[model samples]
Target chain A: MSAIPQFGNWLSRRLQGSAAASNRRGYNAARHTDMAAEVWVIVRIFYAASLMVSFAFITPTLWKIAIAEPMLEPRWPVFWIHWVDVRLGATVLLIANMAAAFFAAPLYRKRWPRVALAITFFLSVALMLSRGYVNNSFHIWLWLTFFFAWLPDSDSRASLMDRRFRYDSVRVFVWATGTVLLFYTLSGIAKFIGAVPMNADKLSSVAPEALAHLVTKQLMISGDESVFGGLLVQLPTLGWPVYMLVIYIEIFALFALFRPALIPVFGWALMAFHIGIWFFMGILFPMQPLQVLLLLVWSPLALRPFSARGAIEQLPLLGSVVFWRRTKPNVSLMKFWWADEWPLFTVIAALTFLDVLPELVKRLLAAM
Target chain B: MNASHSRKNRGAILPLIRATTREKELDMGRKNNRFKAGFAAILVSAYTLVGGYGASFNFPEIFPFFNWALFSFPAKIYNEWVVQVIAIDGDRLSEPADVHLIDRFDHFGAGEGKVLREWGKSVEQGDLEAAQAHRSLFENLYRRSGAEQVRYRLVLRRSNPVQRWEHGTVLSETVEGEFTWVKDSGEQP
Candidate 1:
């Protein structure tokens, strides 16, 4: 009994000592813990923006008149749900899609926030199925929602600008980057594969005429009778370069996977590409450019300002080099994929630059 | 005596605070990072696998990824499909009269002619099933729009969309397919 009191007194003194120590180191510890959380907040904001752009930008009822028949197969297993009046069903889907999108914004990293994300995914799928025409671009949104919904909620609802990096933050970055890269690779594969119809004479090859024809057909179907597309039809020679350029961009988009710094450049190129498509084809892929913005460019712009000269940037030539080094990258492919071999990878990347000059020369010669 | 009593109170509370903080650290430390990442990974992989399979097979209603294969077409094929509703006054088919509700720019028509346009496309694509599926609905709307006896005639013409867009409608070689549905007489199946 006497020994128990003595032990309690000793424990109390130890606790008091540690508590004082914690107060002294509190700032650094708090900052370190919050780094991941801050990054997550940025990502959450981007997700919300993407949701708004995708679900809210278009008039929900625009497709109602075009839905002639109920879909042959509904995405949900509840077959009887399809029995509702088509217009009423479509309206419900549209309303639900918008509601979920509005609520899922900010991705609070809590249970209810996750539920909202889930609802958004299901409703988006339902809306796509409800229409006579479904855009495949929405698939990436669904996959993103699925990943985000699984993230653990934050302890406190602090501002996302807090510079905390956490386990979940890393996971989201990896998953999102992987998904975007996979999409680019798949697009490239689609072009290279024999799936596209070729001319009868050139059974294996895609003739320029055939590609030109398809562009014209797509534009007409979309109600875009643009003069630019008409000009392409009149000048058959322009078709080859345009088609090849499209293929090259689609393939090269894969490079962004290895070098995250190239994402902003890629995003701008994608926007230009989409804008061109809109002008010529009269079809707008709204979600794609938005996806590029949220996935690639938003992170660095949020984290680092170009004008903020770092310690390295102040040094002459070395400072410029350091400035590039200090620029906050969302993820370095070399560091993430092979941290030990990053130096070797950098060397390899440098070596490839030599080949680039020769390749450009050959291309110019060929064009001539 | 008063100062000693105050110190005792704080001393009692300090151990509890330390114990609680330690408990929180243990809880946070034990979080299964792998499991969290694994769940998302498995879900994305499974979805992509199923989606890719469905897309490759060209299954209708499947989320299409490769629907527009780039650089594969050898020729451009552009076709325009038009649907004209002609009223049948006894045996004489009147000069293709417009169905006001379906074609006219009203709340019912919405000015876009979406139904007629899509219906025409279905016919042009040789998707007879899709074309036939909405016959009753179209006829009902036509009757509601004040057409007592009418038949829908589909006219398909091919032209480059770019040319068509720039230079008004130049419909070529009309191929006609007609579906007759009269309000009192019922639909001609």
Candidate 2:
């Protein structure tokens, strides 16, 4: 929280035409152009491959969707899912979804082509949400594909030749970064607000039993018991410190977008956090870590090798040290007014809508 | 973009080292600014609409919009629900074993485990609606498992989740309840 202003100041100093951009003499500009071409390809491949990896999560539910016997009650009661099997031969549906992922880059050019992808994309969503199959990873990856499609493919057109790259690549990169951070922050808000002192009277206290209950239930439900998970739940406290660390990482994750070195820092922390959830409970979200690999690790120009620092620039917290001794980054961030401001507004509203306000609404409606 | 001017003040955004496009970008200058703003606004609008009290669409649970709600509620109600589906033979119940019901639902099986835990709670509270719904679900599982013609026992156990092992008691948990879904012989209790 304290370092937020510093990141903003770095962006501000450059946009305000301060001494920041003047420090560009430290590196070569041509190499950066070639790197963008490489990064452009890497981002797309990483994303498409993530879709293929979703097979692990998707495979087990094949029989559930295939059998035509719906859940006891569908989560949303989507008419087709509950009544008629909307996914005709869910096996065929799975192949279509995987095919869409592979065809994404070639298909996103203009009009007639995108429709083919959209049909398959929506079908994947239906398959994912059917038979009580709902997961956070599914939602995040689906949206990433949607938002990332809007990003420009300037690398193919002209190799970051001039102003076209910002209009194309930079804008969407920032947009995608801001959008994902919104999701993480919203989830953090949901967890954080639960432990607020004012809400302490509730039977479900987050600090004491959030992990105990979740760890126990997930392990029990999944039938994948962990000795650590069992021992942790029976402890004197519910490991609130670990809980606080997660909330802090998620809420602050978006700020990593502002500074290059910070991306991998938050990226590593988030990936570790996701793995921690798997260890405690049998749940696994292969996409979250994979997506983090795209956004923070491989995000264009995010932690792209520092001219002076070699591959060390890609390391987690240590990467920030590459920027530490420098006067300023040779690579200045272009001002993204709309992309920058949306996250601030969305995060506040997401917190309000997800937590306290809903409690207020439920109470108000009850009172009336 | 002035080639000479870009040579002097190169824009370091995006691909990091392009002076040539900087001037053209500045010259074109926010042509789609309104479009960008509107798109951001639309995303925020759609987001707020689909949400509810820790869930989505005013339903207790919904896809994608769900918060995963870990630790927000008490998990003690059903710490471990393996749902032993044992068969009943002449005056004897078959040996207890885990039912394949977990495989029938949940991508990772935790989703079904979580629900059966909820079912256990609802059953404890005498939730008739839940029973009606769960009866159909279990009947489907029984039919799929080919466990007809013999009565089956659905037993739930508690693992003493929050408490420590008292005096090294290996048997910390006991069968909390039993449910019967008799297929034939008109034998349900």
Candidate 3:
């Protein structure tokens, strides 16, 4: 019996050794996979960082102008030159480029989307540099670009892209949170420290005059006092709450990115606040749209784990392929699989062609 | 029979050991990844929050040279030196008069001429000098009026030439010259 037990132990030891070798092989493979993912994340992050820095500089430029030259009268001729047309064109181009990247990321299985995205990125930088006008509108584009660029797509999960994306996302979240907090804390401190009276009676009486002056100084050519007077009368009753809320929101915004549910609520509140300012005070921060986009795209911590898992699971296929598979789960009926998909591909190709056609025409016209 | 059985048992044990080791390695990797991510998050968050705190209270106008160690010290000095000057000069007669108060005249033009033009219609004709004096007194309220440009035409002949002053000429006319200083009930100057 003793001899038999010894023999059994020996056999078990040999089996264990073989299994250990197999396990080591699997571990090596997983490590390699993770390293590859980290590299891709890094690249994506670098791209995001460049875009963000470009955007930050651009935003401040607009603020500087607004502060330096408070537009008392709407210079319509200069408006198109300074504010509207250039921005519209840049926004359209950026949106189109982003759309293309989204579509092409999964298709073609090439780096063209990266190149295209990079081009759009550069275009945004150029727009900021060339365009002097800064407002909430420009900010919207910047935030939108940042959000979309950070989305967990195929490129982001690629070995070279994962670490970059992770690092960049963390960095961006920190920067945004820091900025909001700074604004909030400083505003709060100012209100508390500055001798500006915060009483309802004082605010009601004083705020309207200030608002009127601001509007007359910044917007209306005639320097209409009535609009501001009306707002002042109404705002004083509401202004204190709004002022308090502004501080509250900024401080709270730091946590909103982590808590996904709060984002939509906060986003709506911010939009309402901005719109109210625009309508009543004629003060608009052009970057509100970008902020809204950020609020919408900010994934909640609860959802992040699932999304991260999904990203891992969806790694084998490109973003478009995953989207297509999800959208058309029952498209296995055709006799010829590739033939059946021809219609979809054709539509996508047409859309793609249409998108690039304008640029092509412009280029051709320039050449001629 | 015994040897064969022993060999079979050994083989089974070997595979199990290998499998267990693999699981342990994966667990370690997952733990390490989590630790790094957590560390990065903490670093980013702390840095951002602290930085933001610094930025928010850095408004120049409200807290000019406000050091945390000597909060409100600058304001006190400013009030004593700057505000006192304006008060003593009776420069607070203007609608909004303060150290940082921005007047329209400063931007467009400011001097005896501009002051006279603004108050000329408002003041009684007999009290024109009084109005001028009031204006001059108000002008002395500010530390210094920002610079202004002056333009004049010198027509020596039919060909007129315009001379422009970019730096601006100073308004040094005395308030005493602009208005009659009435004797007070108690004393006369």
Candidate 4:
């Protein structure tokens, strides 16, 4: 009996010592922050908005006939589910997903409902995708939403205005950012490695020609011939450069990941690239506009404020405010990553207004 | 002496910081998350390798996005629009639907058209394996579209991608392949 008591005490001490060592090493609270109130608020809001917008655009018409009609005989399901089971599951999940998207739109820091919403959202997307030939464009959106679902619930708004940053939220935000960056980098690497090598026959290369082929076919089938892509197909020199630029963007995305400040710049540039794709190619990647609205606008670094006259005064050649008394607030070049800043968010929201507002309007009009 | 002192020190803290249920749950959650993150990183790295070396190494099929071959444009410069011509004649149809036919079957779902078009392209590109793999499924799909006899044609409309609009002319249209429709008796439209 005495030996057993002694052994218990020894075991308890060992466990406690290990726990203390772990705590001292700071493994439990790595990259903890209670900062970036404004950015966090915007992220939470935009994330919720993306979900709402996605649900709104979902045409239930895609799966309605599925209940009566069997799935394509040749199609592969991601997992084995009976035909009747799939129909019932699809109906239930679709309805559940829409409801979750609606209820979780605010994205309050509630654990249970948020988790429930995330699971349903994931299942619904998987079902939707598995039903057809997968369009990989939607994959990023689905995964990003799933990441946000796992984020620790908080009064995100309270954190936004509060000066002290929540370490947990910041960690989650950083992980989300890294994951998105990783996705882009992987896409780039894939493109570079899989690139159709340059050869005597230009069309034999898949890099630029395939994209052109796909878009032109879509445009021609739709009975529209006036797009710039049609013109590019005619001009090899101009088109080749554009194709190279795409491969570069996909591969060089790795560099953009480490430079946190440049994330916004990369996001905007990618957005422009996608817009060009939409113009030259008739296929609009549906999730892209929403992604730009939510993720691209967020920057962990605060932008340095600028003043024109002050800049002119500092220039050697230019007639300056040096000719007169200069007045400008000196903005610090370095800022705490956790500091709240709204200018970038405001600017991005303004730019994306033309892109997303129309869809919001269309959805409203359809409802009406 | 040092061991005894350390033991005494551990006992003082151990009683003060007993592993509560909440603490234990947090620890488990953290461990679970770390495992998930590590696993995800490994999967991503594996996918990257597969994308880069898939042609050299015979790996299982990956997602089209990860295939990397999606962007591989051929080096030889010839502009051509690959088009599919389907001719169908059926029992209750008002008339035989030719290349430009619009029907209820066409509008059923977007994926069907896209995948079918891709399959035709793959065949035209001389992917024998793809064509062979999809033969039965393709037949079934054709039947499901409510067509009795279907004539399938893959035509290449040759033009300069850059100057296609400028010339407003097809240099040549080559028929890559044409197949007569044979019905599988067991399959119903």
lDDT (0 to 1) per candidate: 0.49, 0.52, 0.35, 0.48
lDDT winner: 2
Give the per-residue lDDT digits (tens) of candidate 4, residues A280-302: 76556656755754565455431
In angstroms, how far off is A199's CA in candidate 3? 20
Best by TM-score: 2
Candidate 3 backbone clash number: 45
List, residue by residue over A1-368, the lDDT tens digit for candidate 3: 23433432333222222112122223233444453343344334434543454445444433333333322112222323345544445455456455545543443123555456645544544443322111223323333344344433443334233554444444444444334423333333333332243332222212323333223222321122333335544443444455445444533443343333344455566666666655654554545544543433332221222343233222211222443454455655232234333433332233233323434555688799
**Could you say which candidate leads in DockQ?**
2
Q: Per-prediction TM-score, please? A: 0.58, 0.67, 0.34, 0.60
Candidate 1, A158: how far from true, in Å?
6.6
DockQ agreement of candidate 1 with the native complex: 0.13
Clashing residue pairs in all predictions, respectively, total: 13, 2, 45, 35
Which runs in model 3 stand beyond 4 Å of their true positions? A1-123, A126-140, A143-229, A285-294, A297-368, B1-189
Could you list the CA RMSD of all candidates, in the order they appear? 14.3, 9.0, 24.7, 15.1
DockQ of each: 0.13, 0.22, 0.03, 0.17
Error of 3 at A45 (Å): 20
Candidate order by TM-score, decreasing, is 2, 4, 1, 3
Residue-level lDDT of model 4, residues B1-189, one tens digit each, is 699999999999786677675598777665655554455445445554544443222222233323333434432334333334355553333432323334533332334444455556566778876654434434444444555566655555655443344455556776766654454333222
What value does DockQ give for candidate 4? Answer: 0.17
